[model samples]
Every structure is written in C-alpha cells, then in structure tokens.
Target: MTVTGEDSVIDVDPLEPPLCAPLRRDLGWAQVQRMSQSAGHRDDPVLRQIRATAAVRRGTRMTKVLSAAQVSGHLGGWLPYGFCYRACDIAHLHDPQELALLGTDGAVSAEVAYALRWRAVDPLDYEVPGGPAQPGLATLQAHNRVGAMILGTGFTPSTDDLVPEFVTAGFADLPMPANAQLIAYVPGGEEVILYTYQPEQHGWLRLAGPRWRGLLDTLPGVTPDREYVPCTTPGSAKLVGQIRDREYEAVADPPEEFRVRALTRAARYPVSTLSRRAEQALWRGVPCWVLQRDDAWARLRLVRPDNDALAATGARCYERGVYESWAPVGELADHHIADIPYVL
Candidate 1:
C-alpha cells in the first residue's frame, strides 16, 4: 500500500473534521488517568491475566480502507467498467493496496461469492502486514462485499430483492464452502434501508456517517440528493434495458431480519456526536436508554438521544455508563446488549 505524502491527490486531512477540546473538569480526567494507570500496571495477577486476554479482543472500531487507485491496482486487472472500486467494498482494508475488491460485471456477483467462500475458512485471519495471521491477504481476497447498491438507470425492476437475492443466489451457485454467506445493502428510502443476508451469519453492518459521507464525495457526479435507487425485485426486466446482462437468478424473498431487528430489537448505535437533547429524543422512541459505548468517544447515538428521526416515539435511557455499552433497562432487554458488560 503506497503512502503518498500529505500532498497526494486525495487530501485526507481536508476531508477530516477539526478536533475539539474536552469539556470535563480535572477530577473527571484524573479518574480516567487512574484507570489507565491501573490497567497498565502489571502488579496484580488477575488484572494482568485479563489484560493479556483483552489484547486479543478484536477492536470493533472502523477499519481503514483503500482509495480508488489502490482498489484497481490490487485487483490486478480484474476490475470492470462502471464498477470502479470504492473504499466501501472492503470494510477492513488497512492498506491502500490490499483492498477486498468486488467485481460489478455479471461476474461481480460470482466473484463476491468466491470471496465469501475464501473468507469462511476460520475467517478474520486477514490483516495486512501480517502479525499472527499469515494468510490474512488471502482470506481478505476471498470475500467480496457490495456495501451499497448504486446502479445507474437500469431496465425493469426485479421481482427478487436484487441486492440480497443476487448475493445469496450468486454464492449458492458457486462451489463455495457451505459456510459462505452474502451480504448486500439496498438503500431505498431514508426510513427503510434493506439488508439482504444469505448464509444467515452474514448480517447487516451500518456504515459510519462520516464514511458514508466520504463515499458520496468520492463519486464525482453522484450527489447526496440523488443516490442510486435500490432495485426491489430481481429480474425486474427494467434493469435489462439499463444494462446488457440478465442471466442471474433472483430470490423468492428479501432478507428482512436485520431491518426488523434494528427497528424492533437491536440497540441504536450511532457513529457521530449527538447532544444531550438528541440522546433524550432517541431514548423516548425505545424502551431502553444508553450513552456512547466508550466515554472517550463522541457519537450522538452513543451519547445523546436522537430525535424522532432515529428513536421510536417513546424510548428512554434506563442506565448510564462511561465508555460502556448502550444498554437499556425496564423495557424488554434489547437483544443487542447481551454481549456487552458495561452499560451506558
């Protein structure tokens, strides 16, 4: 992965937002300092043991991804027209040259299927400049993901959920391992974002706001006001007129589990800073309440309750924790909080 100096064509610093100072008092900072000190000290056997194991706990933060040049170079000529690679293709690319490219030609569907098969063999082994995992690149190359559906004018609308069905059926046709799954996003309306998952384990992952905003900036002509519309059904015949291919099979039903869960059960996890007012608004819609996962972090969904746009009509924050999990109380347990120990 090439690391062009700050003068590169893609000016990263300009794309980033300005940093702000903390608002807390000295005692608040002192508590954090003490925690850090205690965690760093290796005197107690129990603390040391937990810290050792915690080192392996994969950080859930966003991963750096490749730019357009890196995606094309790494694909090594496998790239297709109108199918330029974007950073969104690989959610975990740490280097510019090590992107997990997704082909968009009719072959794109098939290629992604093959990639998933490759990723399924004890997946999570890929991490550039390998550490413990030697086959990280290989594993990364094995899985291809279409982060968001962005087709130009297409022929007829599909009957099968184009994004989801295409992924699942495409993988099903390949000789990939049974464990392989396909995930695709269909951005329809602001209220409804469709997540199609196949092989079950393949679940929906929301793109961070800033990252999604970056994607909009990357595509030259495509602006936020008019992003591509998601194809609702497969083999809609409408797309045939837009493109040349129509051989891919469609699915019987779109995967709706993730969508349902997010609205009904999964905890609301935002990636940007939200004010206290916003946090309260978000809480009113759902039964449980929460702040950011980590106190040091600053995302509105994590800290403040969002307005009516995100939370349901009557939710509230039941518990609070610093730099902890967004766990609600009193209402039905948000299934999303079971794994998290710290509550915010």
Candidate 2:
C-alpha cells in the first residue's frame, strides 16, 4: 500500500510480516527503548514517516488492553470508552505475555491482565491521533504533561510502540457492540475468555469452564452455573444502519476475531442466552457506573435516569442516555452492577 505524506510517499508491503516478534518480557520505559533500538525497530524511517488516517473499516477488530481495575469496573458494569488500537497494526503483540507489556503501560505489573475485543461499527466515532488530518492534535498534546513525557522520552509506553492509535471522538461512552469479549491473561500465558456480551438478549454469556470458573468468583454476583447475567444499561451512543428500506441495530462481526472455543472446536456462539441474575445498587442515590476512580475521586456516568434524577445530580449529558459527573470518593455509596430486566 502506498501512503502519501506531505514530503514523501512510502510503500508499505500489504503482506509484510510483523515488524518484530512478540515482546516477551515486561520492561521499564528505558529498557523498552533500548530493546526497540537494539531490535532495529527505530531504524526504519518508513515506520517513523508513515502518516495517514487509518481507515475505520466496518468489521475491523479493535483491541483495548485493560488494567486489573478497569477489568473489575467493566464487570461491575462500566461501558468502555477511551483509547484502543486496530488489531492489525499490532498483530504481532496479541499474545497474553506480550499484552501484559502493553497493559501495564510498560511499567511492569505483577497482577493479572485483561483486554476487551470488539468490532468497529461506525467510522464516524473513531479517529487516528496525530494523523495528517488532525495536524493540531499534536500541538495540543505537546502542551500537556503526557505530551511532555512523550517528548522527553521519545516513547509512548501505551501507544507509541504500536502506530495509528485511535480514540473515540469526544471520548464519549459508547454502547457495547454485540459479542464484545472480556479476556483474561493469566500467569501462565494463557488467555481465558470470561464472557461475551449478547446484545439481542441484553446479557453476558459466560464462556469459562471448570479450571477458569474460579475467576468468576471474584466478580460480585457472578456465579459459575449461571450462564448469563442482565446488563441492559442504557448507553449514550449507538450505531444504526438502514437495510432493505428498514432500520435496525447495526453490528460489525468479523468472523475471524469473533469466535469462541467450544469443546474441541472454535465457532461463533449464537446470541440466544437467557438472563437470570438480579441485583442493583446506586451511588449517591443515582444509578451510575464508575468510569474511572482514584483515591480521592470517582468519575461516574448515569445508567438509566429520568429528568428529575438528572436535575438532582447536576450531571451533564455526554450523549443521549449518557450523563456523567465527578463525585467525592468518601461521600459516594457502594456501587454495584444493576441487573435490570430487558425490555426489548
């Protein structure tokens, strides 16, 4: 593929193998740099000069490595919204061990790692940072502490190793695409797919078996025998596409990346699970999901609300059905994932 830049045109072999082998060890930022340079990854000027808005093709698989906290939050019902990368760009780094290197932001974490895998449903919601189209983005990044760190180190532990990082426009929380997967990277470099989201049924289909069922015990309200749990929280953004003169929910399910292991064979699990679990809780008297949290503060978004609830909390709308606010960690009440019944 020929990518044209302002000053030069570079040829990228469509079939060229991965730039490097899977990173084996969890290394610090300084060590990672030395390793990259020693491996000659920094010597390829084509990689450095390559600049183009990666096409957000429908059905393209996207992967976001999650921290241990993020994994717990998601299982506790937090919708994912933030930065992720196209799977193809980092195909060589998909191994569980290699993923740990990326998940910890290269800082080395002794805890278990996790990742979210979903498909691109709409092109409008995704954008490649520092691409040719977003010239000013680089300037904006330079003024921040994150940008300062990047400038001083010449490496972005989370994204720089992999090119063409994409973020959701406005960082808006989006609805979980059907069959979105939650994966666990255990100690022995094994990937345990814990659950798969079933949009049609509005629940998660548990995929883990005997050995890995122990992982479910950690999640509050999740049980091994219960195969599905309701998670129909109202979302802020959804993708709809018209087909055959009718409108319906649109989903991008790339066959290769959207399969599950069943017995001895891998196959696409049909979305027909029934919901069973029932539990709900609130934070500060409002049903909300914790988007992020620290010792002092927790960022939350409303799960389902009416006008009165919105007015009471002073939460601002991020999009339809999505409202968010920052609450003091001490003042907030215990929050739990709501298991509301599915309506449609």
Candidate 3:
C-alpha cells in the first residue's frame, strides 16, 4: 500500500519492517529537518534555512473522526459503552429494585432526581404547581409510564424549576414528612412526590472529615477488637503492583532508572487504623474501598473510592480497601511505609 505524504507516495510494506523504524520516512532529510525545526523560531540559523526550502502543508481539520465504538475502545473497560442511557430514560430509574445497582458494594443507596414537566403553578397554594387542569400527579405518572431512567439532576431543567411553588412548599416543610404535611395541602389538592424513600445506609457514603471518626466513640456495642477505625490522612507515593519480570523489563527498558518516592504521614496511632484510613483516603478516586472477609482470607476491594477526593488531597492513602495483613516480598523492598492512625 502506498502511504500518501505532502508531495510523495511512499510504498509501505505490510509484511516486512526495518529496525530503526523511520517515524518520518516519507519526507526527505531537508523536509524532515524543516518540518521538525523549531515551529515558530525565526532566529535559529538551522531552522531558518530549513523553513525556506520546505512547503508549509495545511492539513484539513477532522470533524467527525472516531465513532462511538472506536472511542469506547480507547477508554478500555472502565465505563460500559451502552450503559449511558440519556435523560429521557429517567423513568426507568423509578423501579425500587434498580436503586440497588447504584451502590459500590452489594449494599443499596437512597438517591432520587425528579424530571421536570412544567413551570407554572397556582399562586393561592405554594405546594400546587400548575392549575387543576394540569395535575402534578398526572404529569409525574405520565413520565413513570415511559419506563424509569436514572434521572440526571445536574441537567439544566430540574423538577423544582418546573414547579417553583411546589418546591417552595417542599423547602418550607423540610423536616416534615412529605406525604402527610407537604403533599396533603396543595391548592388543587394532591399527594406529595411518592418516591420509595429509603434511609441512606450501606455503600460508601461521603462522611464528614472529623465527624466520621465519631463512630469510633460509639463502637462499645461491638467486640473490643472490632471497633471502627477512622482513616483520614494525606500524602502520595508511587503505587507498585504485581507484574511479571518480562513486563517490568519491557516498561523499564534499556537500563531503566526508578526514582519515585513513597510518602508517609500520620493517619492515626495504631497501624491497623491505616486500613480504613487508606480506604477513606481513596474515596476521591477509584471504586469503593471495602474490607471483606471470607473464611481465612481477607482482602480490601477497590469497589468505590472517591477518585475526586484522592485528586484533591496529596495524602497518599488508599481510597479503596487495603489488606491490613498483606506484606511486601522479594524485590519489593523499601516501598511500603507504616502510617500511625489517630487515637481518640
């Protein structure tokens, strides 16, 4: 096959190749040196000479290049391509069973986002948005019939904006039960937004920095060794994982020099606290960090760690699960550091 260049067609042999694989083989030495010269340099003696001879190529800009499948290939296995259902699919999210899928661990989390239908509301009663002609309940039900989708609240249109009056009522009765107090007294008369509201328990919920440690103070219910450990510290270190020698050789290549340093800082007093601390630390990055135990084996699973938090803080801690009992062995020396956990 002939690969077309600016002013030449270089025959590219598919089956055979050369050792010093030419990155710019199609271009002549003058062209290569000219094009590769300091892009905007006018003062350089060599660059000025090269630029004078070379024809400046104006390449066409690409518009629609990579398709969805091609883009997904580049993203690898992190996010499933087809799983991105749009805002209109919000109805499908209504199924109470679907809520279970939002969690990092097998645990379920209670979160909701209502799709907006309209904006006008009755002035007499703040709880009622739109008149009796356009019932709020019917609009919500109509959306519900379309099949639930994960509602994106971050979108421009929100349920509150659609029914400003109703939202005002919602805010007024913040502490009150929606069904009884807020939903009962709409001008047109209606039940409040009837969502299967579950108390947010299980999964990796964002806990306040110091407030999360308060759980440790209340762990008298559990056995002495099973107390909660608060893991909150910051620093960073080059993470080393298991790799075959050949793979390492390939990445390091031609007498590779390793210069990354591991960071150590105070988490809490006892070292066991480092496990949970690392898990919490990783909350800003990766998946959930949960310590799971099965029979004689135990592992820290990288399920749901806050990738955002990790990036925000320089603290070198695992946002996911860290195996407290795991140890370094063979050629993995001087990499691991012990962080003392904070004591109450």
Top candidate by TM-score: 2
| Candidate ranking (TM-score, best to worst) | 2, 1, 3
Candidate 3 residue spans exceeding 4 A from truth: 1-96, 109-231, 235-325, 329-344
**For residues 1-344, could you state the per-residue lDDT of candidate 2 as single tens digits?**
22233565445433221223222245344444444333243333433433232455656677777765566556555565655766666555645556765452233344456788787655555654333322223332222212112111112344346344565543445557668898877776667898898765556788888888777665555566777876634453443433344434433343322222223333334322211122223565876656666798877765443455566677764422235788877777765443212111
* TM values, all candidates: 0.18, 0.53, 0.15
lDDT-based ranking, best first?
2, 1, 3
What are the lDDT scores of the predictions, listed in order? 0.22, 0.51, 0.20
Per-residue lDDT of candidate 1, residues 102-174 (tens digit): 3322222211121211121111211211112211211221112123222211101122111100111101111
* Model 1 worst lDDT window (10 residues): 234-243
Task: List clash counts for every candidate, in order.
Answer: 43, 0, 40
Query: Per-residue lDDT tens digits of candidate 3, residues 1-344?
Result: 12233666445222111111122555444443333322232234433333222111111000111122222221121111111111122322343234223211222223221111111111111222122211222223222221222121111112221100111221110111101100001122221221111111101122223423332222222222322222121112111212222111000000111111112223111111111012211222332222333344323222211233223322232101111222112212232232322211
User: 2 or 3: which has the higher TM-score?
Assistant: 2
Clashing pairs in model 2, backbone N/Cα/C closer than 3 A: none
Q: Could you say which candidate leads in lDDT?
A: 2
